[model samples]
Target chain A: MSKSSFVAEAVKKYGQDRESLMPILQYVYEKKHYLSKEDMQEVAEALDLSSADVYGTASFYSFLDTKEKGEKIIRVCKSISCDLKNKEQIISAIESKLNIKNGQTTPDKKFTLLETNCLGWCHKGPAMLINDNVYTELTPEKAVAAIEENL
Target chain B: MSTDKLQKFKKRIDLIFSDVNWKEILDKALKTSADDIIKELIASCIRGRGGAGFPTGLKWKFAAQQKSDKKYVICNADEGEPGTFKDREILDKQAKKVFLGMAICAHTVGSDEGYIYLRGEYKFLVPQLEKELEEFHKELKAKKLDFKISIRLGSGAYVCGEETALIESMEGRRGEPRNKPPFPVVSGYLGKPTVVNNVETFVYTAMILKDGSKQFCELGTKDSRGSKVFSVSGDTPNPGIYELELGMTLDEFVELFGDGDTKAVQVGGASGFCVPRRKFKETIIGFEGIPTGGSMMLFNSSRSMYNVLHNFLDFFCEESCGQCTPCRVGCQQLLKGIVAVKAKEKPSKYLEDLKGMTETMKSSSKCGLGQSVPNCFNSIIDNFKEEVIY
Candidate 1:
């Protein structure tokens, strides 16, 4: 199915109730990487919610994206446990390797680097989640090598 | 001590990966009356393991008394607390026990439908958790049980861990918490009487039903019964899950998980108290002292106290729902105050002013996120004043 049709189908599957907004956004985000303005508008119309209502809920969450994102999103845990284990060095390594600072996407739009709260990998500190795969107990060298191999 | 020292500690209520007959417990719960189940829960003295140590039986009794056609039981799987990972382990391994716990809760509360508000980051665990749920449903069908459970994903919002905010998220709106006169027990999840319990709480309830409430009541201190599963991490050699009796002293815990150079321990995740080395011997890990939601992060001499406080403050600043002014402004002020002190831009007295601000946030903030956000900040700064200020 096409992207628009897929979103329409997801909206139908989740239902047109106001409570279906989150799931609809989630389904769209999964299918199309980030939530576009047009998609949000479509969802608002389908769920009988205003665009602002849909956008407000979407923006309140850190996972939902209002703008276009790269193919891969790298989230580094900057919580206390990871911080105690040199999270800074690991973040710096990713920046230098990707040639982009935190919260910035690469020039080619292949990767986006962002810092997040605990990813529940405290035992394995200095953890980073690239897309859906979690790499824990990371050193600077290992982080750089992992990103490079994927790149 | 080597990582092997972790084994020397006693394991109690956390039976995540253990093989057990959940069907036996379900059969027993099915045979028992709802009031009897609540009475047994009260006898067991099992409180909600979701950081707030509210009595589990009392919550059920209140919800059961309410007259409603549609009641609900919610499993708070949104384990987003920094330095906490025990719920994730439970969901990953022994998900059926969690489901059984929910079923027991539903049967006790007279609710046939349940929902697990899973955290968004654990989206990867969805396929596996759903598979487990499918099998569980098949078993329920075989046993002629009418209860059913569905999973709802939280969208990367920490505030959703709060019961009201979690309900709002379930309603598909912004995950902001509501005011409290009518708590979730009276009106929740589309304004129905709902009971929300943590993943560990549910598993423990199932265990209690299986082994008998008297067996559970006999385990811990008189006030705080049963064992707790702690997610031990940070500067420790063995950074993993440990299930222990609730009343164990911090000194004993430090001997087991702490490295030789341990300086402090952040008990109960970021929202919990930070215990300095001097107070480790006096502190207890149960309701009589500091109650935890299963996050025990240790700090060694090598770790900077200032950086730790900074990270926690930053997390609160970003995660706050911004609906309440106290939390919204208080978190920002605390974060800025700490930075100013570290840079000598403000006098050390600035911290004293921040302490007063934290008191306001503690009393006035809308939910637990804002209320307990100052815990680590105040404890770390007060305990390590020299390192934090100069």
Candidate 2:
């Protein structure tokens, strides 16, 4: 389906009320991996909201990235629990494996690695979120293996 | 120091994680009058398990008293605190109880609509939660209850865990908090009379009804009643969730969860207090000494206190919704202050100036995130002054 139609479909599915804006934005964000200008404009027009307002709300959330993103987004948990568990090692491993640094998307547009605050998997530290899936208790080997599956 | 105190330390309870026949509890709650249910809740002495320690019964009663037809009950599943993951565990394991608890509140507060503002990081659990909600709606229909629950997603904003911000996010806006005076119980979620509670708080409300008020009230101390679910992590041997009765001293907690070389415990999360080993004997893990939203992270001698402090400040710097000046500026300045002081850019006495800034933030900041930054800041700096300075 066309991206504009996808946004229109999200608005229809979630309803045109003010309450449905987050779901609609999330629907588009997940499908497109990020919200573009046209996508936000399409959503705003469908919801009868201003494009700036739509962008404002989208930009407020970390998950609703305004930047261009890859097919998969890896958000590593960087909070203290994960840090103590050597989260840095996990980041280094993924960076070398993908040949990209943290906060940079791979050249092939397959993965974007970023650091996020506590993923609420404190007990199982060194956790990461790839798209929607959660990978916890990560070693360098485990993180690479998990990323390899997505490839 | 004393065996008598040590013996009373770790009383592991199973009210939260245990499998419950939720229908029996719902039938009992549904049959009882709302006033009577409120009375039982009050008598049970269960406070909001979401760290604030507000009386849960009073919150329900206030919403019940509101003369609005469209009262809403929200389950705050935005579990964003650093070491706090018990809410996720509860929702993952006993979501049925959480749904029923919301239904109980809905019936009590005279509302038909409910929402669970789950964090976006936990999107992985959405499928499981949706499955539970379907079963819940079916159960509600079978019982002929005039209530329905919907799940709303929070897009990676920690401040949304604050009830007003949660309400704002639900209304499809920025998650920055609003001023108090019209708390969520009175005016929340599209300006309706709303009751917002933590995942564990709702489960306890249901569990309170299930076990009767007397059973819950008998468990803990006067100030903090009933057991709380804690997300224990860091240097602990058993790093996971555990439900224990409130009012245990820090010494007792460390004995059970701490490594022998434990240096300090970061009670609560980034926004919670830090307790060193010297004061562990006197520090009670409840409202008396320090209140928490169930995040207990241990630190051993191997770790540097400076790094921990830096991480928390960095978190606050990012998570502080930039709407307010004190939080936005204060967080950035505090982070810079620590880095400069460590690098000898400023004298060590400059730490005192930074301490003054936290006091300013504690008073002037708009929300709990900024206000509570001083909790760990003051505690960690004061106790680990050498580590922070050197």
User: Who wins the DockQ comparison?
Assistant: 2
Candidate 1 residue lDDT tens string, B296-343 = 999989878988888888999999999999999999999999999999
In CAPRI terms, model 1 is classed as high
* Candidate 2: residue B86 Cα off by (Å): 0.6
Residue B214 displacement (Å), model 1: 1.3
lDDT of 1 at B372: 96
Cα lDDT tens digits for candidate 1, A1-151:
1248756988879998877778888988877778988888888888888999989999999988898888788899998888888889999998998899999999899999999888998998889888777888999999988898788
Stretches of candidate 2 above 4 Å error? A1-3, B1-12
> Residues B73-132, candidate 2, lDDT per residue (tens digit)?
999999999999998889899999999899999999999999999999988889999999
How much is the lDDT of residue B123 in candidate 2?
85
TM-score of each: 0.97, 0.97
